[model samples]
Target chain A: MRTTLCDRLGIEYPVFGFTPSEHVAAAISRAGGLGVLGCVRFNDPEELDRVLDWMDDNTGGRPYGVDVVMPAAVPAEGSAGDLGELIPAEHRAFVERTLAELGVPELPDGAAERGGVLGWLHSVARSHVDVALNHRIALIANALGSPPVDVIERAHAHDVPVAALAGRVDHAMRHVDNGVDLVVSQGYEAGGHTGEIASMVLLPEIVDAVGERAPVLAAGGIGSGRQAAAALALGASGVWMGSFWLATEEYRRGMAEASAMQDALVAARSADTVRTRIYTGKPARLLRTRWTEAWSAPDAPAPLPMPLQNLLVAEAHQRISAAGDPSVVSMPVGQIVGRMDRVRPVADIMGELVADFASTVDRLGTLR
Target chain B: MRTTLCDRLGIEYPVFGFTPSEHVAAAISRAGGLGVLGCVRFNDPEELDRVLDWMDDNTGGRPYGVDVVMPAAVPAEGSAGDLGELIPAEHRAFVERTLAELGVPELPDGAAERGGVLGWLHSVARSHVDVALNHRIALIANALGSPPVDVIERAHAHDVPVAALAGRVDHAMRHVDNGVDLVVSQGYEAGGHTGEIASMVLLPEIVDAVGERAPVLAAGGIGSGRQAAAALALGASGVWMGSFWLATEEYRRGMAEASAMQDALVAARSADTVRTRIYTGKPARLLRTRWTEAWSAPDAPAPLPMPLQNLLVAEAHQRISAAGDPSVVSMPVGQIVGRMDRVRPVADIMGELVADFASTVDRLGTLR
Candidate 1:
């Protein structure tokens, strides 16, 4: 169980949990798995430093990682100029007008309302990466795209491994070419935004594509050890989970929120968790909520381009965040929701998955 | 395209292509759109006489249908049987000895020679429904699971429409309970044996499971015109294809196997298809040639379950009927293979499909 991955990240079980919550990262690492803090939401670099310090203090020497968005296909080269100059005025107007028409209320006090979408994401994520790489981070993962060449070089300079998330073979290929140490094949089942491919097929393809160059981690929609095993069977060396930890005791979301997640009947076949630009203006797969419903209306303005989309909805997201409304809030999880019937401790879940995987492999052995 | 499919039998699109090959069914119907032939490989009562005769003689009537095996799940309820009663003492001994020893010739053409791993599939698929129904057969579909019950009832009762081929979703709900027009959410790529689930994601969660309703036509790894449009965006009225046809002057395998099929470099990664038990004694997915070496080793009798794992080296499978050299055989057509690069008589393909389906649907659509 602690074989290959342990050698790579130098962790016990090959479970890397991605979360915005530092508590989760600490808890998982303490529980024998590495929990990487997803850095997109943290705007202040110092906040990241503080969070890392907290994780270090809490995890008691258990190693952890930091994940940021380093997509391989971001605003390609020159087009990235200003990111604003790149978007059409018409598109911008449409997005603004749609918000005006929707009467989405204004943001409350103390909100840092200045530099729009791209500005925020760049400042926050890039800064977090810089801070984490400077700290005791064991790994740095790029969520959206491949890490900029400099980021990879710098991380390498520090002896920290760099990982990236991929939804397709081509995406994974680019990351590998860019020299990612590991490629986390994230399927549609995981929370947040995801590729259309399911875990069953995407894993093997990525594993094959990576060949012997880099280790591969299976991510998205994995809520159980049985699934973790399936990923291994498909050739992934470890499991990267995001949604499974949503219910852990350390998960600080409100009580009602956690209860809804556990008790609600979200069938796998409902219209689908859309890969819409409702969130960061980037394509993301989240639960279809009333907020998303409003934007999807035929009459509503098409979601603004990345950053812009996030800009328009930022306040709404913040309000939901402050208010803790599950009905209209987006919950990122994968298709693996089908198996998340109840909540359990991080250790228990990890142990069960390991045990189940062993049993399943044995079952498959019997077939042979 | 004047291969009138429906007028005689009665349905609509006339795009029938859902079988593993059924004698002359494809040739007969591909001449127009009237008949589609899959599962003719079952070689039972329906094959030798009824299906073949119908395929050869059907006029500009309608699209006829064909169906092969595509499972919503591994070990689909009826897809493969325990065959516990069928396995001869020697076969069991061979299976045991294979694993007990190092490399034993994959399942020794077990005593009965009566049934290979896919042995029960046809009978299970005999789902006479693929053979029943007709109403202009605009399109003949394969209800991969039990071929839609209503198809049989409606086709028989009204003398119109019946279909098969739907790889995932609640097959019981879609093909068994609902009244379908056609349903085959084949993967993104595949030649034979599918269902790891990847029309990226469409194939599995396809909206096919309302029960006793809808005809399903799932063809994976298709290589052709408007296929992406027809299946992904448009929800195909017809499943136009490219694999078997690629081998055909009239069609296009379009992707990897378009030329040498079993002997292409693309076949290595492409041929490790699942939907096991189709050709093998057990269900498994192995590289067309390279990956399967271990299975065929003289002492390694170990194979996967029914159709798949066994599909590679099952001694008794007519598996080599298509590839010839059992050890080097390859079956690489899949949904993603739609990327294959070629074209054939889409018209002949379309014509027969519509023609047979028209007749099939006309015969069945009219049912009470």
Candidate 2:
């Protein structure tokens, strides 16, 4: 289960867990894998700073990382309030109508309106980078692609390596050329935003294209140790997993609504997912639910681009989560949802993955 | 590398090579892997009989298999002319217009017209099965799913095993329940008709569901020994590879139009493909070319259902191939196209796969 990436990232195993919950990330770090906290959910820098402070004290001295969304082109800079105004009225009405039709209840009075998502904005993502560099973080990753060159230099200045997620070979090569220290070959079957290439093909292509320059971590459809071993066999330095952690006990503890999402994921098979841009204006694999199915209708309005789409749907998403219906909840998950049959402690999952990886390797050794 | 499937199928290795060319199938069988010749192209039973005779004599007494397209619901039985009339005039005109736009010249005078593919008719497929059973075929596989129980029993009566391709766990379970002896868990990244699950997730799901009842062979995005090793790690008894053999020297030697297809495939990246129903009535992965692009236009007619769609495009495909332009050639290929950079003998490919599998296993064994 060891590779040069393990030594370089100062982790015991080659597993890198990505989650939005600081609790889950800290638990993963404590469990000997690098737990990367996704910072895209934090709309405020102070909020991210507070979370990082908590992460620093709770990780048991293990290294962890932070992920931010930095689009290749810096989008039009605006506050969430201004971004909300840019969303078309028809799109907003469609979202509201769809939510109401799906029987999603409105938020309670005096609750915060989760309307706009400024987290995907370039300025906010830059703030995330600045805050992440201030912490004792071991790595910083850009979810979209390679961050700007100066950002890489700034991370390097903090002695923190920068990683980028790539779905194609040219993207990996471009990431390396732009000074990224590591490449995460995120496949088409990955949750959130993804490229069209599957991990089995994209991993080897990217590894051969960029492994000489930077270590390649395979992502997408990887839940078990056998899949992790496959990643290694395909020349990935490790596995970058996100969906499996969504079902972790730590995840359940942080997000009150995650139980319903976990139930949805646990009940889903590998084929019960669709890649649609309705999630965030970019194609993302999400569990096939009533919400996603509604958008597939012929008359449904097309999703807005990027930050606007997130802004338009943020409140609807809040309602869906608050409604707590597993069948209609909007959740991004990989096809590996079939394997996340139950919730377990992060340590137990990590132990099982490592054990299974070792046994799988041993089993393969007997083939000839 | 070997598994129980190797012994059961009477092959030296667990590799299952699938191709439409008898030359390539014989070469694969002679090289120690089980070569399964695709029979859907043989509209005439006599033509298929001739090929089987060639395979029997050319395979050096090695075991081989035959694949037929016996759809679960038998398609309408008709002569090619009867079915040809059922296609809408707009669809036919669109095909002709597309060919004209692509500068694909019509067939020369006295040349055979390749339109109206009766091979997809249920009667033709049943005839293929009848002919294959009379030969020394070691296995019979259904490309669609589990053949009718009678078809399975018919093969079993001859002591030959029946294998079916499945993309989901339930499908694999159903296949096994229907008396299929082997299940090929073909993934989303596979060529031709495929399901939505990627190989990494689908392989393990199917293997776990049906491995106790039948062996599972992983198919999709597998081109090299490393991917085959990964499939074994994922619990697949063997690798059912089709796309990799498309670039072999034997493949090049058989079809005069194959060179353009190979050139298109060799120049393609993993992302240079689209899953569309234009090629067949069911969704299939095809190399993204002008032909596919033309069909994707907003005003283009929707592809007809399976056998009808193939009939509609048969002549267009023929003209495109005869035009000998790689850029417009319509070809079915998996995402592994990026790995097929050159032509090689089937023996060379098999040797490389075995050597790589051994070295990959050995490499993983030393990782701890």
Candidate 3:
């Protein structure tokens, strides 16, 4: 499924997979698709550097990208240590109360806090971009909004294309105005931070608005070959998938937490997901576990803003994960989780996606 | 441009246009698409009969359908006259106060009381079905949910196909289980009543769930040939559009109120719409006009449930329409309204759709 985007990115197909696992990223690149490693989990720059180094060594010289959360607007301004002060005592109390009520056990000693407010701060994301650039990364994608102009220019200087995720047409226009190389039009059904617009509506709008300026990647609820074909038909240069890879063997092999999350995901349907700001201040689609439901209670405290919310829930998430309770473990997923009933290898998934896309195209070709 | 759905319904194109105007419906049928006349506006059975007769006379042997709003769950249970008593006086006062604040003049004498709560009740909708069955209607579609088992059986007894609108996979499965011949998977992007799931995610899920049992018609955000092609590629049998025709010449010709609405729609962008429960107590996507904004104000009262909300706002809507105040007129529209930049003939729109679909398919065929 070659397109202009595929040729420009030096990939055989325009299927871009976003995951946090270096194994999944390398596997996707080796299978002829672009696997973008999400850098939000790498709180330590050295760890990020190690991950990128590992990717370079394992990708067999194929190209891959790095994704970082650098939202245009930062809710708080402080160092990682000072950021904790921004979280209100009420939010902390609420999180503690909810976790206790859910029977979630505390994390063991030295389990490591999973996602503190530090990772979401601009300073950390900038560090991630710097580490990513030190490697042979071909693309840099901002998960929240358009990357800062300086960051875009820096990526450009390094001959790396900068892509940004947009949930609306105006967002896509802003990215184009900032000279973004590509825009990932994510729909409300996407796993992470997303806007209210659906992919079907958002994709064509972004494509029409910025197709001349940059190629658009369709994201949200795209897990299969037919959906990828539909995305391309909707004028997207490629399909940017995240949740589809959550069920891959590579993903499970990299993260021990995947066992509980994958078990919940396998049994979950489309309706089992909800868009909640309980995780972060920004609304993100995640599996509707007890952790999410506790926050959704009628009397639950309103989530704190951005970095504060992330801080308030960081310890609770760590505790729940360490407890290995599938019911309370919150996992970022899309409606496509309904289709992920079993685990498969990245190569098999890629083979099926390409084959399905070709067959769907052939079917449409017979439509006249 | 043709499919089994078109052949089964004896139409030239698989496009199904849902409109409240007989003129627009007939024009769509004459233009080789099935125009389903929305029967919710017909408060009286005799009026619906008259409109169907008008459609039969104007369609020139072309196929057409009828759409009725028969929700699966009726929030209010009572006759039309008695249901008015169920509407709280506070809601009535809010509607009146909002209308006065917007400077919407009172309805002129003999304004015909356009839509009483009577039209929305289950009994009224069933009567609409009875009236529609007598006409040469090619299909009967439930707007709010899957039609009752008896309704489906009744339509089947007459050898007529029964279709229903679904916003999720389970809804589509329920419709298929109830023997619906077709399911219109209405996404969140569509105008009127819609579920929270976006079309991109919802369509493919419904298609995969019930594609073998019944053909799925994709609804929501489909205003052009490219979207239609994408829907077809996603496994939808056909494209069902409602908002796209709102800007058509025939629509304006049928309703004098379309002038201001068309102007507002033309100037509106994708974000200039909101899903609100103020109109019918059901969350429906409408152009973000002053009317919707007034209800969204912090001090505004919570909208009553279903028939109560419809009853309270019915007179207000009539007064606003008669006053021709563009700002206060709440028009049901989808994100696709952004694409409706001009008033054109149905035939011209159909031509563009067919041409765009062919070119889109050709473009996809070359993606290798």
Provide the global lDDT of candidate 1 against the true structure. 0.54
Which scores higher on lDDT, 2 or 3? 2
Question: TM-score for every candidate vs. truth?
Answer: 0.58, 0.99, 0.97
Write down the lDDT of every candidate, Cα atoms only. 0.54, 0.90, 0.87
Residue A231 error for model 2, in Å? 0.5
TM-score of 1: 0.58
Q: What is the DockQ of each candidate?
A: 0.03, 0.85, 0.75
Sort all candidates by DockQ, best to worst.
Answer: 2, 3, 1
Over B1-368, each residue of candidate 3 has an lDDT whose tens digit, in order, gives 77788778898889999998888899999999999999888778998998898888999899899999888986566765687887777777888888888899887777677546576778889999999899888999999888889999999988899999999888888888889899999988999998887777788889888857889999998988889998998888899999988888898775878788888888888888999998888899999999899999997999888887887888887787777766776889998887888989988998899899999999999994
The DockQ-based CAPRI class assigned to model 3 is medium
What does candidate 1's lDDT look like per residue over B188-258, in tens digits?
Answer: 34455444444433432453243235433436543332232223221233454525443344322222323
Local accuracy of candidate 2 as per-residue lDDT tens digits, A241-305: 99999888899775888878889988987888899999889899999999999999997999889
Models sorted by lDDT, best on top? 2, 3, 1
Could you give the DockQ of candidate 2?
Answer: 0.85
Tens-digit per-residue lDDT, A246-330, candidate 3: 8989987757877887788888888888998878888999998988888888989888888877777878877877777779878
DockQ-based CAPRI category assigned to the predicted complex of candidate 1: incorrect
**Pairs that clash in candidate 2:** B281-B306
**Model 2 local distance difference test score:** 0.90
In model 2, the Cα lDDT at residue B111 comes to: 76
Q: Which of candidates 1 and 2 is the stronger one according to lDDT?
A: 2
